[model samples]
Target: MFAVVLLAHGDVVRERKIAAHVMKGSVEIRSNHRELRARLREAGSVRDTAVEGIVERLDPLGPVCTGVIDGGVAFGVRVTVPYVILGPIPRETFETLDWPR
Candidate 1:
């Protein structure tokens, strides 16, 4: 999921270009043998052409405890949030419901 976000955010923009080249036209290989190689080479070199503001390192995140009842990834598009604890249980609702004779 994180990878999907990164791909959409111009992180792997060149990869999208490369894929287009590989699948140009309807079942057609638009590029000649040399040209296809060149396109691939260009795609591989996109990162080399850019320097500023690129993510230098993607340090792995998590196994950190999420503070909500379901704050992390779960099965099949579901998220698991952590349970929240409310301090000092309130008794006002119970008291109001009781009628005094």
Candidate 2:
């Protein structure tokens, strides 16, 4: 599980907790050299590709916690596009929610 947030003009506008199962595709060689070459050609090439996954669950991200670093990765469809966490996070006014690391 990881937290995904949307930031606009240095403020957290929206957030969500996403639980996903990542699926990675692979190519294998079998039999002779001709088959291996064909598979290799068909596989093409990729760089810094984001892994595909199915979202198992989604929950709201309640309040922001200051001083404590929540566990999450910058997620996006394209690797070329950048996502950033900006400015100061607002302190949680209420009791802490059970954060999933």
Candidate 3:
């Protein structure tokens, strides 16, 4: 459960209703969280721990995003029409991604 900032055209808005999932110890995905989790794990991260976080269902439409940890901050992206840029949290609170041991 976390907030996601969605960007479209030229607007940045935070979405608190959406879901989030820890894809690994470094990445998290939001929007269609469950399907993405299964898909992500199928792609690689097939560890015993599965995935961490909630799978909040969202209306399937357009515009989705993900992020990662870098230099103690979340810094990653999803290349699309407007090119979505993701987080660094608040420079204080950090997301503890769950990974299999």
Candidate 4:
């Protein structure tokens, strides 16, 4: 499983883990990769569009949202305080997280 960690500046607040395959499908959809979305759906990685809402609500800490996966970064809006790390991030990523101080 991978997870999404919510951050306020460098402080971690909330985190939610999800299935890696579901996360992959979500990243593709959120990134607007049309071909990959179709492929993921066909391959049964993503069942439907409802997964989008599920992933978006994973971190309801604030309004700001973004996705970072496979070292790729994309923001739904300009980066700012109270942002969400939409990761299906692996175990190694957990070790690198900026824990609350």
27 Cα displacement, candidate 3 (Å): 14
TM-score of each: 0.26, 0.17, 0.19, 0.20
Ranking by lDDT: 4, 3, 1, 2
Task: Residues 1-101, candidate 4: write the lDDT tens digits.
Answer: 34444332211111122233533444434455566445544643332233445556654432334543232223321222322444444567557767899
Mind sharing the TM-score for model 1?
0.26
Deviation of model 3 at 45, angstroms: 6.3
- Sort by TM-score, top down from the best: 1, 4, 3, 2
Worst 10 residues of 3 by lDDT: 47-56
Q: Which candidate number has the best TM-score?
A: 1
Off by over 4 Å in 4: 1-51, 55-60, 71-101
Task: Return the lDDT, model 4, position 75.
Answer: 31
Q: Please give the distance, in angstroms, between residue 72's alpha carbon in candidate 1 and its true position after superposition.
A: 27
Please report the candidate that would top lDDT against the real structure: 4
Residue-by-residue lDDT tens digits, candidate 1, 1-101:
12111111011222223345333341223335455546645743563333211323212221111132333322211233222222222355334544678
* lDDT (C-alpha, whole model) for all candidates: 0.31, 0.26, 0.31, 0.39
